[model samples]
Target chain A: MFAFFLSSGLFLGWSLGANDASNVFGTAVGSRMVKFRTAAIVCSVFVILGAVISGSGASHTLGKLGSVNAIAGAFMVAFAAAMSVYLMTLARYPVSTSQAIVGAIIGWNLFTGSRIDTNSLTKIVLTWVACPILSAVFAMIIYKLVALYIKFMKIHMFKLDSMTRYGLFFAGALGSYSLGANNIANVMGVFVPVSPFSSISFYGLFTLTSAQQLFLIGSLAIAVGVFTYSKRVMLTVGTGIFQLSPVAAFVCVVAHSIVLLLFASQGLERFLISHNIPPIPLVPVSSSQAIVGAVIGIGLLKGGRGIQWKTVAGITSGWIVTPIIAALISFISLFFLQNVFQQKTYRPVGYLITIDAAQRIRDGGVSEEKFKGLQGREFPTAVKFSNALSEYTELTREERDLIVLSAQMDEMEITRSGITGLDTNWITPEQIAALELLEGRVFDHQWQLDEALAEVSPYWRFREDDDKYNRDLRQKLSYIYRFFRYG
Target chain B: MSKGILRKQIGIEKQIDEFLDLISESGLIFKAGIGAYLNGKTDDFLRKIEQITDAEHRGDSLRRTLEERLYIQTLIPESRGDVLELLENLDSLLDQFKGAIWQFEIERPEIGPEFHEDFKEVVKYAVESVESIILSSRAFFKNIAAVADHMHKVSYWETESDKVSSNLQRAIFRRKDLSMSHRLQLRDFARQVDNIADVAEDVADRLAIYVIKRSL
Candidate 1:
């Protein structure tokens, strides 16, 4: 059953590979500076490495927006997104898989009555807008520098040709790596919450987490797509589109790679945060859009006569239209899958405000009067509960979300089997010891186990000053949350 | 792989340099051949003719080899067409030089004493024009920014050659002592030698456009 459902995500991965691979290697192959065979090999190897190593950062943001909690639901969400991409592309509308997946996830959220995290949504949308603009700026700067160097150095034409070919190969590699690191979330992120695999340890040298395993499978599908179908796309991109000199093509590829790295690199984010600077959000951005922005930058640098404003307008319209189309498809397909096909798309999560839940809400700084009437009332879904909270309380969105989180009812039991199921490669011994202490404890809410674990060991406790450690802790906590809930 | 690519580049660079050297050497040989012909040294003139004919054949062979290597390796793809056109034009300059020398050998034109210095001047100017255009073509391959520095000199020498060729033709036609056939033959030889400079100027014009197309 898991294999059957995961096929949709693999399909999405394949299509992403077939299309987006061209964005990185197209100009190189088009100009005949790099052969398609060499490009396909370098692209496949780096993409796999990037996916397994750095794929988690962007998926974290997607998980924040909405965690599609059922395998069947994840399947339909991925299927709908893939369908939207295919349908829109067939209709000659430019589309982004990133936008399509985000829309499909939101559709799942609406269907499940889960509250959408507006903050995450805003960050994602902002990155989408900033991606192309940043790429254009990088391209212009790199182009000027390269042009000046070539002029002043007085390199031979043949040497410059050789150098540009080398540059294109390296830049294509980097672009493929960034593409996999940033965009794998769109292919495998929806299945992360319901992933059936556990962390696999290899002689204590390394571990592949459940999410990493899913990413590996997804990236392999992408590699297959690159090997099988990307050659035609590459040829078309090389010759059929904008005619760029080899040097300009190299510059554009470097610029595109840099933009994708800025949006997807967790190390950069951590470095910025550690230095007391605000971090750029790790979001999956469109690789095609980045290349277009780069080409436009080169065009504008050459005095703006070469730019086709019509293509720019077409891509801009795609940003707004692709997601809406995907959302409608996702919602409609999910409805049929749940009712007509008799699949369980969601497990209804009931909300209750017990005495302990009220105490937790009070601890979060919400006034007693705000949620007074909402106490002792049970709601069948988050939508009913939020509606009740609004009727009885005058609170801000954050405060209302806090009430919903605090009052959410999730029955968890830290059983012997659950404790044994935890991978020591991921969980520290001290953290596992804490879990062992609460082995038979039953908790009515997920936060109760968190509180218990924090009390027993400082290893599980989050510190305010250490952002990196806290981020890791949050991941472990979420993983533990799902482990105990399902086990 | 990188080492292999560099080896291939070196091989092609050597071939291109060899090709350019042939053109430059032909210009020098053409000037020497014209001097020998005007001095009436039959043996030296014939030797120069053979040397020039050999140079022209070698230049043609080198050009064909270079064009084949470029297509086979797919090097400098964006500029490949331009480079091939430039090579063909440069080869034509060699043909013009060889053709003029052959004309001297065939017609054995009777030159009067007064026209000797004028003939040398026209040949000098035409050879200088070829020299300048050769420099421009080399710059186009090795240092594109320096191409402009040498390109304009081709037209300058061409104009000087035109002046010398016209004065010599007028001097030849003005002489009533020579027959109409003799005057016409001398005039045709002068024009033939001056046409080398004219072709060099046309090549410079094409090189300018190739430079622009290659500019970043």
Candidate 2:
């Protein structure tokens, strides 16, 4: 049972790395303000710091809501949470692992006949629901006020800008720690159901509580998530929000923190829910979505016309569909893997052959009659033609065209050689006869080469229709290819 | 002077003053552009003004002045295309100045209905630079560098303005309100304003460059 829970945690960690890491540095990475490597480092370090410092909050909620901590119970909770999260990720959705963990715990507790803490669950759910909306509002409200102040005090906008750059850098660093502290639940939620810190430790601390170990392990997992899979998510999140003003960013932080704290509370539902309070489920929500929502809300405040509907729809859809799709995919993949293991049969994958192999026929690469006839004509032999293909690849597009052009010249050389009224002073009779004989064979060899290329790639068909000089190129090639019906 | 010459001289003086007024006014507009930039306003007036530096508008303006004035001479006259070039450079400088202003607006655009003191020092110098040109026309080399001195003052203000712009950008991005785009445009706006001031200094430099070359 302990092994099951541990393995589940590792699986959850992989999924969390894939989906949740983006939450930490998605905006920075998306905008290319920080490279992937830099973002990863900052996220990992700060997450570790946050987890080490303040990671105990979620640990209490996950572990202590009932009488005794059982390893079997913890294992069950971890498996359910991991399964839920893993299912969500493969579908390219950004579901909250924290929410999934919380839900799974409740499900397990309910099944085990344990009393559910509706009030705490309500607070958690409300936070999930409110997180994105509140983040957006915070960004909007603070953005408007602070931006207004900065604009009015134009005396030192430039100076203030330098200050902002430094400040944001500071915030980014701070945010990392917050992520470690706040998001550890996504990592260590299951550990709560088992023995309270019996097997976990920190540094050389004696009898470290379960909460403390969660702080360390959760931070470590988050760091891994940040380093591994944060970029893709960050890009999705960053572009989801309209280009933000400094004020908007400030507001978003305030909103996210407040909302997160609201959910983090033990008695949030009874404390905040009014008679007409909006119904919100207990779940962990996304901060990125909250900020994005806030940005859109501001735009909507201006009017629907001001809001970019497409961007809004795209983001909302991503929010809605990500989890379900991930769930579906995970279900299917797991099913397939299970069935495949049971079947014990794997199909072998097929082989490829080359032109060189075709040329190696004992019957001869070409017929003697055709080969001799081609020799009498202008075409070069197979060996020479093969060399041209290798040489052509080395040339640029323009040089390749020049090679095609030389094919026409080879024909001209034959025609010029056979010119009955030509002056013999510039050309000799023997050379003329040789040129005449070589022309047909050379031209035919070039044709055969063209046919071969057409079989493999069909270069002309691959050309983009929008190419400006394509018409001209086609016209020039009209005569040469006319015999082969290229026109 | 005939009434026509008197009217023309008055016209030149008025136009020169108006141009200077526009420079100052545009500087404010430039500030607004900065505000807009910082505030994350994509549609900035300053950014539009910066686009004026393009060949079409300036080129057309240059053409008009050439056609109106005695600019295309067979032999280089004592008074060559100096006025024509001067006006062209002035227009270019203003365009660049306007561009700089947009940088501020773009990077941190959230101007309220209040005045921006950051522009006061920079604007004074710019105004002085314009006044120097007008004064130079009236007194031509008589009070050398007196107007140039004011232009020198413009340069100092520009440097100060640079500090202000940099400060604003840093401050704006630091605030939680700014997005990635907001910070970028804010920085751009600040740098652009400094560039405008630099162009104003370039005007002064051109004046000096022209004199040194011609006088020698």
Best by lDDT: 1
Per-residue accuracy of model 1 over B31-115 as CA lDDT, tens digit each: 8888888888889999989998998989999999999988998899899999999999999999998999999999999888798
For candidate 1, what is the DockQ?
0.73
lDDT values for all models: 0.82, 0.48
Model 2 Cα lDDT, one tens digit per residue, A360-419:
221333223322212222223222432443443454444333332233211212243234
What are the iRMS values of all candidates? 1.4, 24.0
- Judged by DockQ cut-offs, is candidate 2 incorrect, acceptable, medium or high? incorrect
Error of 1 at A211 (Å): 7.9
Which residue pairs in candidate 1 have backbone atoms (N, alpha carbon, C) closer than 3 angstroms, thus clashing?
Answer: A30-A238
Residue-level lDDT of model 1, residues A163-266, one tens digit each, is: 88988888888878877887787788767766899999999999998889999999999898788777766654454445678998898888887887787666
Give the clash count for each candidate. 1, 84
lDDT of 2: 0.48
**Which regions of candidate 1 fall more than 4 Å away from where they truly are?**
A48-66, A87-96, A181-217, A231-241, A271-286
